[model samples]
Target: MIKECCNKIDNNKVLLSMAIKKKRYEALVQVYHSELYRFAYWLCHDPTIAEDLVQETFLRAWRSLESLQDDKAAKPWLLTILRRENARRFERKQFDYADVENNTLEDNKSVTLDDEMEQTVIHRQINKLSPEYREPLLLQVVMGCSGEEIADILELNKNTVMTRLYRARNQLKEALTDNHEPIKGALN
Candidate 1:
């Protein structure tokens, strides 16, 4: 009888724990959805890709939610998930060299915005850079991650992250300062 009673108590505790986990997941989805969406949007310029990235991020986060301890670190944790999702997406999709080269050669005026033309201009220029340069910039600018955090997300050494970020900024500055007339040999 005692053994049976202990088993019943254990089952009840498991059920209660499950209920709490569900509630926390729901609350997390509510609070971080927008931030995740925005981060994904900047990662991929397309809204559809952003939605997919955020969805994947949340799905992974849900699976690993038990490992997460600090609620305050949720934002960075979510960002890390999104970045990994983005990388996995590229790996699974399997881009051809021709396709990648062709894409890099394309013009990127699509990054335009109404209110902040100059900033938009700079953004488009940044967008034009190869992903090696673009990823770190977005992590820093859009996601507000520190250098070490960016390094971890991008899976690079801290020095490498710093170098790429420096190069990205310098390239953007040059693009912005270049003559108003488009460069003669812009890829696209």
Candidate 2:
């Protein structure tokens, strides 16, 4: 009888632990899902692929949640996971190429046609930047990561991250100027 009662207590403990873990995981998903999806979409330029990447990233995060020590580190942690998931896509299979022009732009806000055109131009310019420059800029601008967080996610020193960001801004400014699409205070 004592053995059976001890077994029941142990089972209850296990259940309680699982319930806590599930709650934590759900909270994380709610907080970070949209940011992760935006970052993924910019990285791949494909909505479908971005959605898949976010799903895969969250799946991996769920599997390895116990390894994450700090809750404050969650954004950078999730970003790193997402970057790896994006990399894995190349290893798994070659994806069919899609024309960037053909992909539909999804905008929730009401903006004028001129504003939309300007945004398209800016996006194209951003996409033209090399990955080394582009990735840092995206992390900073899109993901809203700080210099330290960007460095941590990219596995680079903070100085290196800042330098890349500087160069990226310069390059983007020059591209916009060359294209005659002067977006005032765009980089600021």
Candidate 3:
């Protein structure tokens, strides 16, 4: 009788632990899903692939949630997972590079035609940036990550991240200037 009682108590404890984990996972998803999706979209330039990458990233995060010691570290942690998941895509299979012009720009929010055209031009200029500068800039501008967080996600020193961000802004400015577009605080 005592052994059976102990077994029941142990089972209840395990169930309670799982419930806590589930709540934590759900909160994490709710808080970071949109940010993760936007970052992934910019990285791949494809909505479907971006959604896949975010799903895979969250799956990996759920599997390894126990290892994540700090709640404050969640953004950087999830971003790192997403970056790795994106890398794994190449390992799984090579995808034919699609021309940027072929892919339509999608935005849910309503904006004027001029606003949309400006966004398209800015996106094109950003795409022209080399990966090194582009990655840091996107993490900062798109993901709103700090220098430390960007460095942690990219596995680089903070100085390197800052340098890349500066260079990225300069390149983007130059590109827009060449196109005779006024710099309308896009980098800001």
> Any idea what lDDT model 1 has?
0.76
Runs with alpha carbons beyond 4 Å of true place in candidate 2: 96-98, 102-105
lDDT of each: 0.76, 0.91, 0.91
lDDT tens per residue, model 1, 1-188: 99999999999999999998899889989998977786777666666777999888889988999988988777778888888898898888964434321122113456434324554555578778899998898888777878988887777899999999999878876776674544333322
lDDT score, candidate 3, position 47: 89
Candidate 2 per-residue C-alpha lDDT over 37-80 given as tens digits, one digit per residue, 9 for 90 to 100: 99998888888889999999999999999998999999999999
Arrange candidates by TM-score, descending: 2, 3, 1
Q: Tens digit of lDDT per residue, candidate 3, span 1-97?
A: 9999999999999999999999999999999999999999998888889999999999999999998899999999999999999999989988776
TM-score of each: 0.74, 0.93, 0.92
TM-score for predicted model 2 compared with the true structure: 0.93
- Better structure of 1 and 3 per lDDT: 3
lDDT value, candidate 2, whole model: 0.91
Error of 2 at 92 (Å): 1.7
Summed backbone clashes in each candidate are 0, 0, 0
